[model samples]
Target: MDTGGGMNEHWQGVAEGLRDDTALLLAVQAEYRRLYERCFRDDPAVNHRLPVITHAFRRLGRWRVFLLLTPWMLARLLVPDEPPDIEIPADWRPAARRGAPYTMIGPAFSLELLTGRQKAHLNYSTAIGHYFLHPLVLAMAPFPTPEAVFGAWNDVIAARNANLEKMRRQNPQQEEISRREFFSGGFRK
Candidate 1:
């Protein structure tokens, strides 16, 4: 089925749901920020060589600074001089470029969108969700509302759940096939 309108409708539904669950959203967002900060700091050096380490450190340092400054910047805009709702841990630092640590920023952001309390701060979430649902919104010039923007998001979730069910149904059969192959010495090459 054509999911264009449905995708946008899903986005709206998710956004509305988040707005209704503001407290939970805030808590989740706060947790995400902390996780991101931790990843940035705990990243290991990609190479122990001094030159590579230096280069990676420089890049990571700049990224770390930007990440560190984000909360302060948001605080200034949202509540001047007030402490940020989320606290950056003492150990928080940027990940080295060489190590390229897998920061869970994407999932954290998704969680924020899933649980955000304020619609005004949803620009980031909307943008990210829009990208994910790009297929549905590609033909539309500008999505009418944030809800419409999330239509693709809902489609993705439905698709994922369906896939999981299909996998579960096929897994037993696949396991049996594997066992038969093993017993038959099918690996002889």
Candidate 2:
């Protein structure tokens, strides 16, 4: 029931936040927890396997980006910048006729791969097929890529750190030691 709603007095000093920024960051974290739940929701080792499964998802995403999308983009360069293929006349026949030359058979074989009905893209993509059909490469990024959250955590942490820094910078007595520090050193009086 944590809505990340209104803050109390302790939170009053925080810098201005983006609309639902805290919620969004929490959502991103929740997405990871959901991923963990996907694999271990019913497992006995659910608590123990969170790190393993989350890392696996990150590895899968990197593999898809590097192994599938990178090469697919490169291979597409072989395609000439041309308009859609022209339609065939009703009476026209395919190039593969009986005892035809080997060169003529190439076009007939290409049809098996390209159905031209795909809608997958960079955001949510599969290299070859749809959900059940994606035999080779499939990537689902509902939130930020899990790997990216490791390095680019500024959106979640920067503001709070800035607030703490502001407090440290503006406090005139910061250079002076507090009574806690003074007493901790066993100073008399």
Candidate 3:
């Protein structure tokens, strides 16, 4: 149970965790950038939300991260996160699909990849990493504009797909589902 002094302690623990967990920090940085561009760039209101989010993130653990994210996810579903309107060629073939409520592409793989690290060495479990750590990182970091974010996403997906096609050989050690599959709005096996 947490007393009133838990906020400072929680933040201290998070900082210590980040110092120890280089991979986790890197993953959080990447997701922070992505989410800022995708979700928070246009809305300056994100600035206001950050403090509350930070407090909640610090106060709660992994399960509560879901408590915060689930509502955001549901709101997004109700109001669909449509890409901004733009002129495009009618025949443009998208290289990768858009993400969904629970897609593994963003923070899941980073947090949960089975890299065989010892339990003691592991910085955070999937729930904590994705829900609390990633969001905390985003709240603290700066992000590019939404257009820049989407543009980068496209470039990354295209390059990755091209490279995957070029190097057709499969490596089980680095196996991953493509963004195309992830955002296909269909069931994955």
TM-score of each predicted structure versus truth: 0.23, 0.23, 0.22
Write one digit per residue (lDDT tens) for candidate 2, span 119-161: 2211101111101012122222222333433333345457778
Clashing pairs in 3: none
Candidate 3's TM-score: 0.22
Overall lDDT per candidate, in order of appearance = 0.28, 0.26, 0.29
**lDDT value for candidate 1?**
0.28
**Ten consecutive residues with minimal summed lDDT in candidate 1?**
48-57
Our tally of clashes for model 1 stands at 13
Error of 1 at 142 (Å): 6.3
Model 3 C-alpha RMSD vs. true structure (Å) is: 20.1
Better by TM-score, candidate 3 or 2: 2
Worst 10 residues of 3 by lDDT: 74-83
Candidate 3: what lDDT? 0.29
Each prediction's Cα RMSD?
20.9, 25.5, 20.1
Which candidate wins on TM-score?
Answer: 1
Query: Model 3 off-target regions past 4 Å?
Result: 1-110, 113-144, 169-189
